[model samples]
Target: MFKALVVEKNEADGKTSAAVQELSEDQLPEAEVTVAVEYSTVNYKDGLCIGPGGGLVRKYPHVPGIDFAGTVETSADDRYKPGDKVVLTGWRVGEAHWGGYAQKARVKADWLVPLPDGLDTRQAMAVGTAGFTAMLAVMALEDHGLTTGHGPVLVTGAAGGVGSVAVAILAALGHEVAGVTGRPETEDYLKGLGASRIVPREEIAETVKRPLESETWAGCVDAVGGPMLARVLGQMKYGSSVAAVGLAGGADLPATVIPFLLRGVNLLGIDSVMQPYDNRVRAWKRIAEVLPMDKLDSMVHPATLEDLPQLGRDILKGQVKGRVVVDLNG
Candidate 1:
């Protein structure tokens, strides 16, 4: 039997609760690969999965962990073999199937990617889905002509996981990075991640009265949507693009089309969950290549399976910072 974080529903109350329990290997869903999960990371979706159904977990008695890094112990698919180091991020594994919250995980071979060079399982979990998505956002921005020496690049929610990693990577690439955050306490943290300037959340959190503001940002990786994103759209420099990664603030985009029409601003939607495997591999490679190991180390907030219950609640309340890497072996 292996230890796993299980969320079971109470039929009496129609509510869900999570706990770490021993589960037999045979209880894991049959799949192409069996992984001895070394490390997993908590994501925003994990908060929902650990607490309640959140419409993401269609079934109860669920193991919720959206990203994990481990070694394959067994494989039925030719694409993978025992002893292969692997990382998994999406394909709805945590929500729709048994995930990496356990010491052992069984998943489809197509969902696994060979762990990139220069990164160990622990480092990969530190990058997690949040960092992976941040890399994707950066790649999208670069694909749209974002480059160094182009006015400052903006990263909203800069103190958070995705925002923090984006700030670090963007700064490493020689772009002047401006991080936006509500908490003044994170100013030093953001600067530590290489943000040259800090934009107060209140500065851009409100809906702008004007359709087009001063063309400021050359590029942006927006993790907080809603009014903040709507406001940022108007501030983007002409022909610039914003990679919309998450809707932590709000999903409804209350903004004007003037930015698109007059400024040629592109709002690129970044979906890491359904990204093509080839692109996923490409992004992971880019992350391992460009993202500084020291900086990645700075962003880690370590936790264990037992810490997940409260950590999940904290994440949903926007109380967690950087990345929360769960040490399954701990």
Candidate 2:
């Protein structure tokens, strides 16, 4: 038996509550590999999964953790063996299937990536799905002619996990990074992670009156969607691109096509989920090579499985900063 954070629904009241419970191995979903989950991270999705169903959790008594890093304890798949380090993300494990809120997890080998060299299980979870998505956004921008010398790159929702990692990676790659955050207190924290400037959330939170503004950012990794994204669209430099990563602000895109047609600006959609294996490997390898350990360390807020309930609620309220790495063994 293993300890897992289980979200059980009270069918009578149609409400959900989460708690740590002892679960048997037979309770694990059918899969090719069983992992000794060492670390997981709290994400915005996790908050919803841990609280109300959010339509993501299809059943009662769910385990909610979108990403985890661990070691293989048993494997029927030849691709991985016992003691092999692995990372899991973006296969809808937390939402649609059993996830890594437990000390043990059974998952398909295809959903797992061999933990990249130069990173341990804990550090891998530190990056989690958020940082991996950030890397994907950065790579997408780079593919579309984004270079360090082009101009300052903007990272929206900058104090959040995705924005924080994006800022660090862009800064490390020699790009001038402007981090956008509503929280004034995080200015120093964001700067510590290599953000050259802090762009206030109010400055770009609302929709702009003009469809096209002065070309400011050469590239952007936007985590806050809604009007902020709409505003950023009009401000992109000519022929530049913005990688849309999240919709923390809202899903509505209330903007004109003038930026695309007139300024030749491109808006690239970044989806870390269902990314091809080769690209996933490439991204993980790049993360291992480029993301500075010290900078990543500065962004970490550690927690344990027992702290997840409150942490989940905190994340939903945007009260959590950087990444919340949950050490299962701790």
lDDT of 2 by residue, 282-308 (tens): 999999999999999999999998999
**lDDT for each residue of candidate 1 in 163-218, tens digit (9 for 90 to 100):** 99999999989999999999999999999999999999998899968999999999
Q: Which residue pairs in model 2 clash with each other?
A: none
Which regions of candidate 1 are displaced past 4 Å? none
Per-residue error for 197 in candidate 1, Å, reads: 0.4
lDDT of 2 at 228: 97
How does each model score on TM-score? 0.99, 0.99
Q: Which runs in model 2 stand beyond 4 Å of their true positions? A: none
TM-score of candidate 2 against the unseen true structure: 0.99
Error of 2 at 29 (Å): 0.6
Cα lDDT listed for each candidate? 0.94, 0.94
